[model samples]
Target: MLTKLLITDDAAFMRMTLKRIVTSAGYDVVGEAANGQEAVDLYKELNPDIVTMDITMPTMDGIEALQEIKKTDPNAKVIMCSAMGQQAKIVEAIQHGALDFIVKPFDHSRIIEALKKASDR
Candidate 1:
């Protein structure tokens, strides 16, 4: 079976771009969310194999959502998405049970590699 993925990002363009890249890579795009709260809700409903989560968002940012998800499912596979200069938050996310992180503007190879690593764990 193809790996299922839930992509969560506030930016419409980023979501679309990520969807395209992962779909092309042969992952099934199981769900998408615009913010952290939505991500958490979709996570419960879809129970995707992995989540690509954006750190900065309007409501209930990625770290908080990651925490919430972890509380519910300790083994949840989450790969945080971060931009440059968010080192503190990235470290926090990792400490909060995120499996890994992907630096944005989304490197295709890195994204795939992170997914592989997260899933392998």
Candidate 2:
């Protein structure tokens, strides 16, 4: 089955990029959120199989949203996306239940690979 995915990023361009890549790779982009708060809300509404989350965003950061989502549903699969040099945040996200991560400036392969890992999780 196609993996249903929720995309959360503060930037519209990044969200579009991820949506394109994920959809092209055959995963369904079930929803898109411009901020972490929106992400949290959408997660509950959509219950997507996986989520691609940005570490930095207004209203709420991905880490906090991730935590909130976990609180809502522990089995919710989230894959964090971040720019380079945020290893600490990435680790924290993983510790808080992020299934995997994809660094920004992402190529098609990395996005697909991350989605694959999230689906497996």
Candidate 3:
């Protein structure tokens, strides 16, 4: 079966861009969220195979959402997305059980590679 993915970003453009990339790469675009809270809610409902989460957002940030998801499902596969210079937050996400991270504006190859790695684990 195709890998299922939930994409979370505060920017609608980013979510749309990511959806295009993941769908073209053969992943099923299960859902998209404009913020971390929505991401968490969709996660519970969809149970996607992986999540691409942006680190900065209103109504809850990616790290908090990642933590919440991990609390509910320790094995949840999350790949954090962050702008350059957010190294500390990225590190924290990794420590919180994120499978991997991709820098933005995202590179197509890196996004695919991160998804592949997360799905493999």
TM-score of model 2 vs. true structure: 0.97
Instruction: Put down candidate 3 lDDT per residue, 1-117, tens digits, no spaces.
Output: 999999999999999999999999999998999999999999999999999999999999999999999988999999999999999999999999998999999899999999888
- Structural similarity to truth (TM-score) of each candidate: 0.98, 0.97, 0.98
What's each prediction's clash count? 0, 0, 0
Query: All candidates: CA RMSD in angstroms?
Result: 0.6, 0.8, 0.5
lDDT, candidates in the order shown: 0.95, 0.92, 0.95
Where model 1 places Cα greater than 4 Å from the true spot, the runs are none
Which parts of model 3 are misplaced by more than 4 Å?
Answer: none
Residue 64, candidate 3: C-alpha displacement in angstroms: 0.3
* Per-residue lDDT value at 56 in model 1: 99
Q: What stretches of model 2 exceed 4 Å from their correct place?
A: none
lDDT tens digits, residue span 1-121, model 1 = 9999999999999999999999999999999999999999999999999999999998889999999999889999999999999999999999999999999899999999998898788
Query: How does residue 110 of candidate 3 score in lDDT?
Result: 96
